[model samples]
Target: MKKPLNAPVLIVGGGIAGLALGIALRRAGRDVELVELNSAWNVYGVGIILQANALRALRQIGLADACIAAGFPYAVSLHHEENGQPQAARHKPSLLDEGLPASCGILRPALHNLLRDAALAAGVQVRLGITVADIRDESDAAQVSFTDGSQGRYSVVVGADGIRSHVRTLRFPEAMPPRFTGQGCWRFTLPRSAEVSSAVMYHGRQARLAGLVPVSPDQMYLLLLSEEPGNPRMPDAELPDLLRDRLQHFGGQIPAAMAHMPGPEGIVYRPLETQLVAAPWHRGRVVLAGDAAHATTPHMAQGASMALEDAVVLADSLDDADSLESALQSYSLRRFDRCRRVVEASVQIGQWQMRPEPGADPLALVREVAVELMRPA
Candidate 1:
């Protein structure tokens, strides 16, 4: 009789996707270990807009209650016109009658810490201070060699290491390189007085997008997005002046937010990019998940949620397939369609927003395409 394969399945990232996967796979009675690249051991962002589909997927993985406790739920999401006027276009509760609420806003670090605590409580081993040295494709199992000269061979390996993933680069080199979406996103968190209650987004000239995400009753995440400028180096003292100049035309809450900004020390500039993989997401005992598989633009706020969904599908497929490769194949078949749809949709939204001038009026666009968007494809 052959010894049953019992090594822990390895997850290469400890972000939302990998942590959720660790928790879910643990709930499913599978052993897993999450290896994170960052030595700091904390999520970096200030906040994110959580989607309903993501909430439901978390429920499927037994994380619903925990997630709810960690974020603030809102029944509506609003979009505004370029002149700082609120538009009639809104995502209301009805749109999510079959899904989660319209959205939840969360402090990324708080949420990550909560999920990490849950994963640890559920008995997922997390190994820090390690890097992948090499990967060997044996007939029976894929072996992952670490820099410390430690090797782990398992029945399955999940590549959730994020965009620029080592496993993806090693195993599927021909896959699409990450493409920059030609936008620069600057985000910051400010401690706000408890007077603000609503989340808001502004569309301005050249289609710049600025938003305030209230992650808690006490703090808000402010984001200003513009076209990525070449040789984009600005001094710390110059940031505030630059922001004020760029946002002066937006008026309303936008200019006020800029006026009240916490300054350069609080801001982080991120250039957006996406990766497309046009292959089987797995080979033998290895499979990709999260940004390792598909990293999308943040326009729709489905990036984190899509990764959460990946975990549930992967666990379901693994439990159902007879062989490891077959399990990976089943997982790809189950998740590829939905994940790809989200990635493609996110990119489309980014493309539409990153125009050289002010975007078409949402009212006009809605009148023109809302019916088509609502129609069955």
Candidate 2:
């Protein structure tokens, strides 16, 4: 992939996808500038699981070692009864075959810090507390206006803003809004224990899904998924009691973890929602990627992974293709169906969990998706 001359690229949003793309492009000796709407550059949530496929993408940009150093690595996903008795353990399929763990769990901020440092080190100019106010695409270049009353011309403009993307609203006015998936997730961080080695999930007899994910050698986090009929809002003050009450059906390490709730700072609750942009992700020199293109539920744990994959693929496309149009088209063609499958499959899993039948096998659905994800995205 040869670098293009005078290809000043403007990327909106400095989250996972945006930052990763900045690193990739800069490492390839491309001129790129990234803008993030958040001035503080804060990242919410506790921990995230990086599946093998996500790790592969990160490896492409030479950040896998840093990620592993900052997170906990595990090769298995264990299912347990409410009493903490082991029910079944499914080992994730290894694609790299280089003796690396199949998946990893890391604190969200830790991952963010790593990516930010790498992006800065690669010479990618990052501007915070700014956003794109306007975008006009022409035959060979894109003119972008900033909220700070600044303008620039670039070979390409990427919208990695997120699900509630301003670029999506401005570029694709007819795009459908993200839909609620009738589910909400509750998370709490806790100290890691000797007994917790892998991602262990407890299946409550009353149809609740809760899990303890090890994020590091001495830290871990708990995640609970329950049905939310109307996508109700949850207040921060009530999150502790609500989470404790919901964990009553489970009897294992969950009780002990619940006992150590550290006020509102330790708890995070969010309603599950998803969105999938139709094909033709690019309009002339402006393109969309990551959550702006496809957002999914935590059921399949592929959201961040998808974003990382998008960054690597997009950078590669830009380098390999002959022209800006060719590069954006190649990036879209490579990512569309792969992302659609993940979004649809993740939503399907959430739906099945919402309405579990007497003989329904949720594990089968999970295994099917996991197997497919083991393949290159």
Candidate 3:
């Protein structure tokens, strides 16, 4: 018989993964406490693309409809040549049972707000501007010391703290660290055009990739992926012009969008990085989820979806297992392969982009992965 998980669950780093886990566990009738290092709880990225699988996962927690309503839902991705000529259009089939759209594009803050509000409504205890300083896994529970000079004991401590996770550092000192993927991403927001109803990609020279995604009814975000030899960081004051220059080769609506680019403050830039820890994602009573265990490039747009699936599966495992050890093992076993596929595939696509093969088909690989992801997480 499985033992009931009646003890409190401590989730570190209240980002997408942590918040989703908090909501899932709380809905499962477990006590959950979430801590975020940032007091204001601000999100950095301009927008995110949620694929069908992500929406399916969100549906399990009653947030799928809300996300669909808030974001722009689309089923087709349009590909164009560097000079604005249409190349191809790929239509994605809906994975949801109720015929929901195949994908959604939403602002980062909007998605964060939805998850945060839902987590709070589900009765998660939230502590901001805090993080774990130390964690000692005892037989009965894991004792945690917070950076704010507070302490607590919980049945399990989950590290959803992201790629540079502190809890992961303390727990898995020997695990692999995050690696730079030799590429940088740039994003800028602009008014959505009437014709921009779906995701549009423009393949540029020298393997540069640019795309436009509608985030809402009236707003869309432009994204560029470029090879950065040393991952150089440009000054914030120079980001606007720099991004404009990078997109100079892209035609279509890109030129018009660039014309209205805001000052440096409007540009969002980040060097792509990825990490995937080898299995056994848990040690003692400490477990890692989301980017803490596997951080993938945005090439697949499955990073956040994978995190959401982790939260749901972890909660389900805990509820069905006979022991904490067995539950953690089950969760890791189920998640590792799926997450690894995404990380590897995404990295592979980025690598191919950096060094294109004569007959390599990234779009085909993407379609293959998308079909695989249509299965239940």
Candidate 4:
């Protein structure tokens, strides 16, 4: 008889992917234990944009409505010239069953709190300030040694940890390291303007790109993308001033938003890096999920969406398959191609922004990918 997937599962990270997977597995009648390295579990970033595909995945696990209620929902995206003259607008089609919006912009903290609460409510055992020190995949189970000196045996081990995944290093030592995409992203939260109703993107002549996304009724976040020749460590004290200097060339509501920019503490900046682990996301009973398996740039805004889909699909596969190996195989087979498209497409868009060619159209590629992603994950 094939081994049953009834034993407890271990998740090594408690970020968006880890939390979502915990909820899905618990709902599927599996005992889940999640470990987060951070003790306080503080969420970083100003906000996040949840495209329709992401909402669909969240809907599968029963969190879509709450996310929509807590976030600013809209379906329109406006493109503008450097001087703020409107160039074009496109409406995204809804992917959810009910009459939900096509996309949502939400505060990172708010979304994190919702997932954390749902995972706990679903009876997931969560351990903070702890992580896996070592893992061994045996015939019957995966032996895990926690950083806290405790040990456990789980039916399967999932590495949902981010790009710098310890589990990945321990398991797949041959995988390529994360590659820098030669660009950095800057984000800051500001009070929303009444005129800002939809997602707006500014094609700047002086700067590469900038965007404004509404996170709530009275709050919005600014995202600026620029080419950083060599990845430089920007100091926090100079972040606010540096961000303002970058935006000075653009005209529009940006000046007004800049007026409300707070101290360096309120700004968030990070160099964009991407990684996609090779197919067969699992070896033995140990598997990889979310950013650990595929980390994409924010150009497509599908990083979190892909992670959420991974959770739902993985749980469904485990419940439907007869053996652990086949279940994990099905999960990777179903996800690899779609995720590869998103990752590669996002990187291409970032490259276009860095070096513009005569015929390159990032917006067109975005639309094509969006339509493809609307399909079932």
User: What C-alpha RMSD separates each model from the true structure?
Assistant: 3.8, 1.5, 1.1, 1.4
lDDT of each model, Cα atoms only? 0.72, 0.87, 0.91, 0.90
- Candidate of highest lDDT: 3
* Model 3 C-alpha lDDT per residue in residues 134-173, reported as the tens digit of each score: 9998778889999999999999999999999998999999
Residues 323-344, model 1: lDDT tens digits = 6767778778877766676677
lDDT for residue 49 in candidate 1, whole number 0-100:
70
**Clash pairs detected, candidate 4:** none
Give model 2's TM-score versus the native structure.
0.96
How far residue 248's Cα lies from its native spot in candidate 3, in Å, is 0.7
Q: What local lDDT score does residue 7 receive in model 1, on the 0 to 100 scale? A: 73
RMSD to native, candidate 1:
3.8
- Give candidate 2's whole-model lDDT: 0.87
Full-model lDDT, candidate 4: 0.90
Query: Runs in model 2 with CA error above 4 Å?
Result: 1-5
Select the stronger candidate by lDDT from 1 and 2: 2
Name the weakest run of 10 consecutive residues (lDDT summed) in model 2.
Answer: 1-10
- When 2 and 3 are scored with lDDT, the better candidate is 3
Off by over 4 Å in 4: 1-6, 96-98
Q: Can you list the residue pairs that collide in candidate 3?
A: none
Q: For model 4, state the Cα shift of residue 16 in Å.
A: 0.7
Worst 10 residues of 3 by lDDT: 1-10
**Cα lDDT for residue 74, model 2?**
93
